[model samples]
Target: MASPPPHALIIPYPAQGHVIPLMELAHAMVDRGFIVTFVNSEFNHARVVAAMSPSSSPGNNGVGGLDRIRLVAVPDGMEPGEDRNNLVRLTILMTEFMAPAVEELIHRSGEEDGEEKITCMVTDYNVGTWAVDVARRTGIRSAAVWPASAAVMATLLSFNKLIEDDIIDAEHGSAMGKETFKLSPEMPEMQSAHLAWNCVGDHDQQATLFKYLVKGVLAVDQCEFFICNSFHAAEPGAFSLFPKLLPIGPLLTGERGGDKAVGHLWQPEDAECISWLDAQPEPGSVVYVAFGSFTMFDRRQFQELALGLELCGRPFLWVVRPDIGYGKVHDYPDGFLDRVVGESGGTGRGKLVSWAPQQRVLAHPSVGCFVSHCGWNSTMEGVRNGVPFLAWPYFADQFVNQVYISDVWKVGLKAVKDEEAGVITKEHIADRVEVLMGDAGIRERVEELKKAAHESIQDGGSSHGNFDKFVEAMKQA
Candidate 1:
């Protein structure tokens, strides 16, 4: 008798944030007895290999001995040496390039083993429509993975009505920045300013992103299962919005263990941050700060944030990437580093690096609070680590994630956005950080939510149960 199919193809969106959660989910599938093939763009595949330590190899089964998980690369259709200065062009290329690459992977997987065809596809929600096309063409099951909180997805779905009512336009014009609007009756707490600004960029760009989003949402209707990186209890209102949505989150389980799992698109994670964290005074005594990969801050704003950290008088680990501004290297204002060092009495309680091992840093006992951009991956990591948040939303679903963190879960406090100046002052930042860290009542409230977040992802918890159901459904499909 012939053997059963031996592989599953997992395709995630190319960004670091999107890839990490999908990688965790793929690991879960591997643990449950499946051959996993994680596909990445060629550029990303090289990065992942470069990032891995000898011990971190995928295993005999492929790079560290993940045993069942294999990494594969597909072309992303960019020219060999294209300029990446234009965000609009990059976005367009990502959408257009991926479809053919994914289709080619399906064809190649089918040819590898006659009986071991591509049984199913696990893909990011943004890639949903393409996955659907591949599934239809190849006769395989496809599932959509929403690597975002349920609340954010619900908010995106509401844009259709905003467009219908002429409150928002499918194309950008003078009307794009006219006034803020509310999302839906269900999400009355969300304001129009919180919706993705990409929706209001140049007309063609706006239409392209909206088109991709709409197609992804509609493709969910055809998926065998819809997976969300969220816990049901974390966003009850939004959880109720989707018929097929499955919550399987706080995805960074077993983080403290030494097991090496490959992330979606990998870069050489700076492990030096771990040693710096260890040298801190005590557990839960330091603040961890990071804006997700794509967030860029102007020079003045970056200085204010640095000054705010100093003014708060807290030990901190801040990750400031080179591309944080419109320059190659981040240059702080004069004497900023000197001021912070002097405030710490020359012991350098503050450590700033371009990148860090985020999971390990979050899980570190010394981390007491997180000042984050409210990206979904970071939010889940914070919740899982039982840390409270100081939310500074930048773009995309970040604003919606902030709503869940501050308004819904009550585990976070939002940074005030300045309408006229378009910048937050150091004083405002210092005040909020102090309130979140020093107030006993606020600390207690944050801890309560942290406990609840932990419970939601534990065995027999809502997220855990949903994960099992999702896997079972995939088996049946």
Candidate 2:
């Protein structure tokens, strides 16, 4: 008799950045003949369903295409009318509230008719530890997916060592007045301020994040294998620090080939931006700016970014999510948008939207540069498309990603932030955009990295080999 097809339960942290990649992984698994159950928070699950609902776009039919892939949701313990953006609340939900529901779901998977037995589980490194514990209890195989770059993961993994060396006080969330450190001799230099969890919020918040990191390290250590959403070619030094890590990514896009059903939390609105991009002067002539799903800006910073984009005198596409600018919906500074369009002598060269089809936008030939927040997903997209960056990192792993892009990869230039004022002014934004746009060497390097990214996922490539090995490991388990 033939064996049952492998069944895997996949979960991500309840964030857009985390959900997208895990969805891509599920797609790949389905292609490899695994039955997949993709889990999301109740709120985000609705958003994703809405985003993929019929009457949206081509090839988007609310998960109708992939018969083997199933999406499931569990309550995140968020009360009605509560602010879902609260980090403390989210952490509590992941560690405490969501555990029972997930475990119960696992139990039900076994009883569902026509489904294979739950043989394996895969989850995001930061958010899926609770699921890992459940998998262990049920005698199922499990792996932790590190959803960030290998470099970022390596830095987080070194937190314990940094504490022992007095480089950082993990208990008190203090960094011993030191501004810089390296994870290893071969690793790129990192700013203490750039540590993803360092000084993220108030003292209590910082301490909470610190404890989360400590717990994450321990949870990851317990996993059967650590799967990273990065390619070994990108960060060799960082990969060396974690020998057990399986680097099988640059999973920026999926094999489904532009299918909108691959779980976008936010639907792509205002797609006219694409036609506007096509009408630009030439290939690699327009600047593209997006600060990812979360980064918030104050009024001054918002004004600065708008005015600065106008001052650059370039054809540009900018995504300004509605919730940005402290969620107040601040008006643009008195015809700033008009001035940007009017400056190019009546052709309306600049376009702004609430959200963009990012992968498609970056892949556009007219897009020359990316002004980004350096969220790992955005970072990977920029690299995948060979678009050099004007880095404007706000918080979290963004600052570290900016270091890798600007200082290490040499394909991006950091936007000067007035750290004292807690903003990057108009002057700094304009200056950095001009500097980054003018660099032929950076553009060339970006093209090389883009080629490398594509190559890594091709047949016999490093990522391909690693992914094959990972699948075999899961089968053996």
Q: For residues 1-477, write the lDDT of model 1, one tens digit per residue.
A: 845644678988776777778877888887776678888777767766665545655433343344456788877667766644334565567657877777777787756534356688888887777777877788778788989878768756766666765656665411344355544455537665456645335657655676667777787788878888887767776766664687887788323236353562334455677887888878888888898777778877887788888888888888777552532333666676666654442358777776677778887999888999998888888887777899998777788788778877788799996767678877888888877776666567666766777887788888888888877766654
Residue-level lDDT tens digits of model 2 in 11-61 = 888888888888888888877878888888988888877766354432332
Q: Model 1: runs farther than 4 Å from truth?
A: 1-6, 57-67, 81-91, 94-96, 113-115, 164-166, 170-188, 197-203, 253-261, 264-266, 324-330, 339-347, 418-422
> Residue 286 deviation, candidate 2, in Å?
0.9
Q: What is the lDDT, from 0 to 100, of the residue 27 in candidate 2?
A: 82
Q: Model 2: C-alpha RMSD to truth?
A: 2.7
Most accurate candidate by lDDT? 2
**lDDT of each candidate versus the true structure:** 0.72, 0.79
Instruction: Quote each prediction's TM-score.
Output: 0.88, 0.93
Worst 10 residues of 2 by lDDT: 55-64
